[model samples]
Target: MADAELYAALGQLKLSYRECIVLQKIEGYSIKETAEILTCTEVQVRNHTERGMKALQKLLGGEIDEIG
Candidate 1:
């Protein structure tokens, strides 16, 4: 998908603030770093990443490979 479409879909996911942050930041940063940035524990970061990605996956028609 195009960048614009992807971003639009992300916005439509209705994710929490932390979920968005975790998903976007985790691309280059480690879970530890993401937790630091969000001022939360590493487990929270993992949870947010997992939930956010699942929601995004569902929104994008369950295309696992397309997302990862």
Candidate 2:
């Protein structure tokens, strides 16, 4: 898809700016690292990721099996 389309998909995910920042910027981290850096639990991080991905898929009009 085009970059605009990708961004539009991301936008439809309903993530706050901060949540988007953490996911995009800290993507290099392991689950533990992500939780530690975000000051949240691994479960929370996973939940956000899942929800965000689902939203993105809805925006993209497809089923997204992965985010990366």
Candidate 3:
């Protein structure tokens, strides 16, 4: 998808601030780095990543699962 389309879809997800930050790929940091940046535990980062991705996948009609 185009950047604009992806951004629009993401906006529709209404995610938490942390989820949005992580999903937006801020500098493409790993989970550890993201946890440090967000001042949260690595578990929280993983949770956000998983939940954000699931929401995105659902919103985008589950096409992400077909990528493989």
Evaluated against the true structure, the overall lDDT of model 3 is 0.63
lDDT of 3 by residue, 1-68 (tens): 55665566667764564353443364567778777767888887777777777777777777564211
lDDT for 4 (candidate 3): 68
Root-mean-square deviation of candidate 3: 3.7
Candidate 3 regions exceeding 4 Å error are 14-26, 65-68
Candidate 2 stretches greater than 4 Å from native: 16-26, 63-68
Best by TM-score: 1
Cα error, candidate 2, residue 50 (Å): 1.0
Over the stretch 1-68, how does candidate 1's per-residue lDDT look in tens digits? 66665566678754563354434543667777777766888887777777777776677677645432
Candidates in order, TM-scores: namely: 0.72, 0.66, 0.71
RMSD of every prediction: 3.0, 3.3, 3.7
Residues forming the 10-long window of minimal summed lDDT in candidate 1: 17-26
Per-model C-alpha lDDT, please?
Answer: 0.63, 0.62, 0.63
Off by over 4 Å in 1: 14-27, 64-68
